[model samples]
Target chain A: MAEQKQVARPLSPHLQIYKPMLTMMMSITHRITGVALYGGTLLVVWWLAAAAHSDAYFAVVQGFFGHWFGKLILFGFTWALVHHALGGIRHFIWDMGRGFKLPTVEWMVRANVIGSILITVLLWLIAYGVKS
Target chain B: MNEMSNASNMKTPLKRVRGFGASKTGTEHFWQQRATAVANLPLMAVLVWFLIAHFGATRAEVIASLQNPIIALLLIMALASACWHMRLGLQVVIEDYLHSHLAKFAALALNIAIATSFFAIAAYSILKMSFAP
Candidate 1:
């Protein structure tokens, strides 16, 4: 490990150097969730192509989605979707010249975080609550 | 009036344009992605409601719903818009996080290929369902 150590170059100013602020946190979270969204796309494709083919195929997907690991993945997907969706709305608002004020920006970040969780939980509850 | 207008624009229009910063293309791509997302907003709601209505139904039933002209068209539109949006988002992620320039370009190309393939496959599936007897 010591022999393999490489000299590092000056790094781009990242989240570390500055005191974390609400907008910074939201920006970072947006990128993180964007990465998660890639995996979510795979899940979407699986669900679609499985349903497109046959019952057995769809059942295979349904069975996996019914399992614990699958549930966890799906939970992450849901959270990513909701979080990214809200974050995009926040960006859109900023693009339109609203929600840039200090207090509003703080509230927006807090709202995005809280709202994403609440929506994800609500979705899971409804998913389990459904009859079929 | 001539002096006032001339003074208001001291620099030639070309000079003023040249004064603007580099790579207008990036902002155009960003705006296009936002436009697609705005379109997807309503389509997404429709998809959610459609799925809920057909939830847990058999594969045949779901396919039948997809075969509906309106639903098929909407699904294709949604999938295309989504893949485009995903491609743009992932490109930025690659550019930001990937350290090696070669690796960054590779990832960007791979992301585009995957998004294109996903869209193609989805369009094929929709056509198969919609057009097949």
Candidate 2:
């Protein structure tokens, strides 16, 4: 037979082909939140280093965190941490060969998101409540 | 069951399992990732709790909190496990997306360095604060 023509074929199952699902969103968010934790971790490390040096330095650090922008970032960081933690639990359960049922998976994903938001809000509420 | 026969057979489950096969490191990596994550659950909870409890604490107040042996110990453990888990997690991310060998190598190396040194700095601060006069 003659050599086959070298025609470039379009790839099937294109990137945007699939409809979005909760499970898919959860997987993506888990990774994105995991990476975001690094920034939050660095901020905490910086805070610790400053606290070690002197009260003056620590106060300067606190001032930044007290600002509206810093507070917003910290809130997001807390949410990320909470979301990732719950997602980690979901994986941990799967690693044990359980919770593979569709219903269970869907339930866990929903809890991972809703629980993180609730817990983070509760934490900040307690923080501000105690502050007053 | 002798080694000669086993070697000749080349059908042992162990041999079948390297590369994913004989080495078995793929599953080993998976287990380690989960282990660090499990360790993080409680340690991170404690760390978060400690932070909230000390949200606006002054230097002296904070130092006193760290000075408690149990608190410092938990903080150190939290940092160590967290950073270790962070390195493992990022390694997977780097390996997945970076198609180029050079890019993967650089990112993995940087991930390890940053994660390890982050724990060092964090733990040191906790210790120095705890031990100060």
Candidate 3:
């Protein structure tokens, strides 16, 4: 009868050991922005709940959202939402078993990044335009 | 005696039903995630349009806009789908990173609870606004 020997194994290469590629960077950001959307959804719930409560409550919520810090947070939320949504679309395409080629993958990654920023900026521009 | 003899070699009905060993819900989870992802694409567009249209509007104005049957219904649908989708996505991330069994279980439970609570609140608020007198 042969006895099996157990030995310790080294950990897999992590962030410090591996060079970050665009795809890898975008993958991590996709996750991060996904998490950000959770917080943003909570804010949306709060705003809705306030509106349901009363005009005064809604006004308070609006006032908070109108503040500089509030606007900053909202901006981040908007960007995260757009970025994550675009990233989801990219993943969906991959799931369809296409876009595996290097060039195509790189193009998708770039699109996720740039498309998110452009859409966020455009939405915000429309928002400001509507506001005033 | 024959039944007892057969039991030793036979697979249980429950095992047969599961097809996949423990936690036989894997396919359902994956399918639901993808379904919600597809649903969110257009729903999110609607949500963005609503936000852009209503930006800087007064409380009454916002409420009135939301009070529209189509707008409120779509908003609720989007909120439910997005929150459910977000919870599942976060669950995958937490499961991958959290090594401890206890911590992973707690995190999964927390993810579902938070998502459900947020969905409930948002849905309730939307309904309230839509049906306001």
Candidate 4:
């Protein structure tokens, strides 16, 4: 049998060590919104499946989406989807080896944040506007 | 003679490390992610448009709109690509944060199963609507 030795080691610096910056914040939001999109996609599946099942089932699903809480969730889902998509574009730009400069990265992060919210609101407004 | 014998007995470092080099699939994964991201750009726009058009529409109208061949095709493509992209993205997240081996494996498997089944269900529904009327 071999004996093991104990050693003291320093741990990697974590969230407490650093101030939050726009890029860092956006990166975290990107992961969160990605996960949220998974749930949102499931809702999309539910809606499609309900429609295929029957009109009654479809109406139930529609009614659920029409309710206040459901609308809130849908709103959140829309934001998540758009945010994640923009985050992905940012990632793609990085993959292409562009936008690595601090200013460019920060600008991209800000754009994603603003663009997602604006687009979501615009989409809902359009929906309501066309509806009425 | 001694040098020849040493050379024959010793393993070249490259030979020892060859199989362990890169996973060799990192590039493929990166490309797949980027490709799907690009595809999703247009597809997502189509999805938003379709949803907006169907908003407040009656059941019959909704079905009729989905029955459009172009709409059905685009919807399925968007959903399938989204599932693929989601699975790849989540897999990276799991690999990064899930330190437990068993937990990581379980999460990866669950991710695949969920994405696959969701895509299947959505695709089936779209196909049903397109053809069953």
Candidate 5:
């Protein structure tokens, strides 16, 4: 195949070629979280399946979620979810042909980073408060 | 460089090569991805809110929660869009990083299988709990 044929050519640079910046890292983080959510969504799906089975089944799943380790996973999942969601908003804004200015890009990245953390933390707090 | 103003045109390299114009798969994939994303942005918010409300909830309480037709409908909608979006997103990931043709094909197939089963399980569960329990 032509793709298998060796040829001398200038190729795309590795990620190391460019100096890392917050916005660039945020872009990568978006993809990373997107992949993580692929697995994370399974957890939520399992919860629904278990709940559908019976109360005993639901309790087992709920117990796992109550455990510290599961909580950690849930926390990571939620962080990824929020980060990716905000990242999507940034992408949507760009897709709309706005927010292209350098300063605006910087502002959007900063807001995404902070807002994801704040929203996730608030969600967990509310969850705990409701549970208590 | 070609003096044809091709660079300024809206056609992507793949689109120009394939000559399918607007019927190109990439455009459809992109539009669908965005459509699902727009749907998810709000549906996901409502989902998180519902989850928090039911956090650490028992089966009966969770059952009672799903008893509301509106909530069940919302969950089903969220599952449908999220599954579709996830499958499309993962397909792009596979297309980008997997250089081996066989591996890329396998991954894409697996992505579809996994996304489908996940949606099936969750949707069935929601329906079962909603109508019967």
Candidate 6:
């Protein structure tokens, strides 16, 4: 029997060889924010359950959230949620067989980033405004 | 045994290719994720509007609104579907991106644990709300 030789085939373009573009960055950020959103959803459940369980439980959670660290994490969670939500919309558009063109992809990435930041800022403003 | 050997001998190596297996279940996951996202389109809108309406309300009103049986049930269903969708999407992502088997296994385990924990918490919260006075 002859020895079988392994042959190398052409590889597709991936993240390693090429410089990261905005669309690629947006795609990866969408997944990371998705993971973050999973954790954030747990926090929401905790808050809701506490509110449902008893006054004492609610008080404990509220007290913790009132702290600076909790506020910071909440802010981060808000950003992740908005970012991921817009990313989902972007993917939805792509799924509809659109947005793959160069201009549209670039514009969508810019929109996702800018829209997420804008929404997060707006949310924080409303949150703080309500607090005051 | 003789018939099985004959069948095996007649088959080509490519017949054993590992795509979707005999059950054809992979597409169900894809379908469910899309279905849930579509469902979530409306659910999310309602949820956001509800939150805004309850934004300035007292804690009592918030609890009362959540405790409503329809809303409570919807929330439970939404949470479960959302978690399921998250697991499916994240699994595809990990499979596509993560090349290291060990790292992929750990990430899969972490994703499962988080999904399970969140589901449990949401279920418990729904029960608590339903039973709350």
Best by DockQ: 5
Name the TM-score of chain A in model 5. Answer: 0.89
| Whole-model Cα lDDT of every candidate shown, in order | 0.78, 0.89, 0.89, 0.88, 0.91, 0.75
| lDDT score of residue B6 within candidate 4 | 62
Write the residue-wise lDDT of candidate 3 on B37-113 in tens digits. Answer: 99999998898788778666677887789878999999999999999999999998998899898999999999999
> What local lDDT does model 2 show for residue A125?
92
Instruction: Identify the runs in model 2 with alpha carbons over 4 angstroms from their true place.
Output: A1-5, A8-14, B1-10, B18-24
lDDT of 1 at B94: 81
TM-score of each: 0.82, 0.90, 0.88, 0.88, 0.89, 0.75
lDDT of 6 by residue, B78-97 (tens): 77877887887788788878
Runs off by more than 4 Å, candidate 1: A1-14, A129-132, B1-26, B51-55
lDDT of 1 at A12: 84
Best by lDDT: 5
In candidate 3, residue B45 scores what lDDT? 87
lDDT of 4 by residue, B93-122 (tens): 999999998999999999999999999999
List the candidate 4 regions with Cα displacement exceeding 4 Å: A1-6, B1-24
Arranged by lDDT with the best first, the candidates are 5, 2, 3, 4, 1, 6
- Model 2, C-alpha of B7: deviation from truth (Å): 17
RMSD in Å for model 5 = 4.0
Put down candidate 1 lDDT per residue, B7-87, tens digits, no spaces. 647666566455444654535777888998787677666655554454455777777887789998888887788889889
lDDT of 1 at B129: 65
Task: State each model's C-alpha RMSD to the native.
Answer: 5.8, 4.1, 5.9, 4.9, 4.0, 6.5
True contacts kept of 2: 0.60
TM-score of predicted chain B, candidate 6? 0.74
> Against the correct fold, how does model 3 do in TM-score?
0.88
- What DockQ does each listed candidate score? 0.38, 0.69, 0.65, 0.70, 0.81, 0.30
**Pairs that clash in candidate 5:** none
Clashing pairs in 2: B17-B21, B18-B21, B18-B22, B18-B23
Model 5: iRMSD?
A: 0.6
